[model samples]
Target: MAAFRYFSKKLLSSTLKTDIRAPVSNNYVVCVRLLSYTPMPYDGNPDPGPIFIKKEVQTLLTTLTRVDLAKVYRKRKLGGRQLEQPVYKFMTDEQLQEALDEAKRKVDEILQIPPVVAVRKPRDKVVSRDPALQGLDSSNYIFTDISYGVPDSERIILVRDTEGTLRDADWATRDRINQMYFPVARRQVTPPKMFEDDKLDDLLKRGEYNFILDRACLQFEPNDEFYQKVCSVTYQHINENNKFEDIRSTRHFGSFAFFIAWHKMIDNLLLDLIESEHIDEANALVELYAQLHGEKFRGNSIEEYIGKFSTKKAALELALQAYKNAAKQKHALEEGIKRAHGLN
Candidate 1:
């Protein structure tokens, strides 16, 4: 068929029966399957070119990083509440006093200190009170009002300007401290509904229905792309005339049937020729793809990634394993079909 030989090699090597246990913390089991309705795109379309659409989808799914999640969380306005330190603790005693003095000086220099009273008898012609000096008590001088209270306690100091008005700076430092510790925003716990609806809404709402509606159309299609090539070889020898046909109609069936017989034979030969390369990234790809599929097909929630595969390869293996396991459980999809169709 087209060049799906690569996929068969990769698929078979990876799909051999394996029992991957479900993680203890998780409640979901993941599986993989081809998302296709037909094989038309691959029939005669050899050389699918370098730009395959499914690869683009895989890239988008798996390449999402923490930074991208951060952006999305920011847009959704869902984030952890950042704790704030006390503002009073951030300032030193010198800064507090400097601010207080600057504020007092701007009003009036005399206001910086309390004013003295000029005492005299206005009608006394002899002026018995010494004009050179008033009986001023220097010890009780109001100018030195710093020791009025405890060393760092709050005390009221009033000053009268030439205009005969008073000004007071009362507990301004405490007010500044209060403003600095103003409450931060509260965090919101995003309901599971947002992820469930948003993720599948676009694919279901926007994708063209034609890619999914016609199966027979895919049969005669060229084996030009990666997926199409796999499907072509996978379903070879089966009648392509009808839209609804099971893969068992062909000789290659069961979990290990194709892998053990046909694909393995060709894979070794290809490795001798091409020296193929594979990496751990393949597992990540499978998981991402399965996640998207579970969300799309099973109506699973993002917060509860329970119904999807954790990786692309794992999902595929799960599917193959499921098929084999179903047989071991004395159940097969064909038997289910027979019962449904009244042939059981």
Candidate 2:
């Protein structure tokens, strides 16, 4: 069955013009990513957020992403006005070059991923208690500072419970009051139904990873529990589906790669890199693995690193063989054409 599936994949690839890796059948049970090197998904844990922030690891992740400037500056849905007129500017050679440089710098900052910290625990500190104010209301009174220029992090929020205990507002109440006062452009006070477990699962099954990620980034802070949970589950789903390319070149890819690397499950990711002909990036991933684990590699090649993989050994070997076979076939075809034209 395995041999048959591989043959069928090759035949299908020959027939398809634009899409090579997309399966011949959407319902095909087999994952097409080189026989599932590292079958199980890594739980986004041991919170690599801190380790990822290290200068060397950040550089490696950025290199793996293979940034595309066009995609980097692509306008995204901030969810306010549907239409806006494009501003036109006329400038000389130096002015236009400076403007382009400035734009790239700004986009680089925007693409800098939020740290994937562990979810923040709630704080329920009692600010004050008033016996005289007790029994004044059945529900809590929520107050928010709505002054302009007040950053959300520093904004004061207070909740007065029915017992007259004034405390820091819980996350839910805080979000509600923040929305009431200075609402984010598209986020809801109450989260959308799609974020619910069942709905989120269905979306993941449908491969709506980018949508989940984009909405999660917009709806919650990077450190929020719900935000972390959503991203965690989505990353797991992408891993299970062998769909790393789905998040590649976006801001999320760095975090995604870091998540897998942190868990020491880089086989699938490494295979994906090799299959895509990203040999240098694959080596960079190995370098990231060494840094994360504090292990020293004697050699720089992927061959040296594969000896360390405990799972998916046979499958990863086959994947490497297949990549080499493909590269040879491509080179031979190019040389044959050259020889036919008497140029080689």
Candidate 3:
């Protein structure tokens, strides 16, 4: 059946071409053997024969013994076949060169154009101070909404010192900074540290907290459940206490400290969920913060990330089974080969 299919393919290829003589059906055996070295569509593999078709007959003759090819050709020709003269005989060297050169030029032309970049420039600014920027604050924080376009968004920190120089506690712009601090503090689920203006400034510089917070606001969480939860938790944590030391002494620290602690808690909580295959829920809980604020996060689509997880699991199992089989067969193969060669 395979031999019949093979001969049929060669017959079809010959018939499809014009200006080329077609092979006779009687030469099926020779044609089938020659076509074995060529890939077939039955294997769903691309035919690579066209790539080597331009090779010089002398070069081909070196790799393949002439007797082998001639035997196949002669047998087919003698089998009462209407012989198709080799196509190479009809094409002069110059004609072949022109064909090859044209193919090369087309390939070169295709490769010359630049590919389009997928990421377009964001049409919005990072921070804006305009009254129109109110609802959009849900998507982005507005520090100064000046109309002049900046190349990239920036986190704005307004600092005004009463003493002018960098003196400890002497700065009167503490109120302005505190205003920003309060909003962030309200967002933290637990007040981990004392709520003091100076501590807030120090925390911002020490932890690089604003960068993390900025992303959290813009993160795309479905139905906004996670965002609402985070906001409410933070608001309660900060407003519930009055004494700064008492709040600082509590199990949860200020916003910066609470953010870190909350992440660890969530990671621990989700481990069992992910392990037990309640991973979709685990993903939902982790996804928003993971995209925006999580430390170990890298950007990945939900499907892509899950696909990688399944693939890795399958691959590991296959590798382990292969390793065991290989180990068991290792010395047995050597012994068998030695005995087969009569050297044992």
lDDT of each: 0.29, 0.76, 0.34
> What are the per-residue Cα lDDT tens digits for candidate 2 across 178-297?
877888988888888998877887888889898898888888877677777778778766765589877777888888888777766677778877877888898899899889888888
Clashes of each: 19, 0, 13
lDDT of 1 by residue, 276-321 (tens): 1121222233334343333343432221222232223344345444
lDDT of 3 by residue, 76-108 (tens): 213334767855546789988997677655543
Using lDDT as the measure, name the better of candidate 2 and candidate 3.
2
Model 2: lDDT equals 0.76
TM-score of every prediction relative to native: 0.14, 0.73, 0.16
Please, what's the RMSD in Å of model 2?
7.9
Kindly report which residue stretches of model 2 are placed more than 4 angstroms away from their true locations once superposed: 1-47, 73-81, 85-107, 130-133, 145-150, 322-344
Q: Could you report the Cα RMSD, in angstroms, for every candidate shown?
A: 34.8, 7.9, 32.4
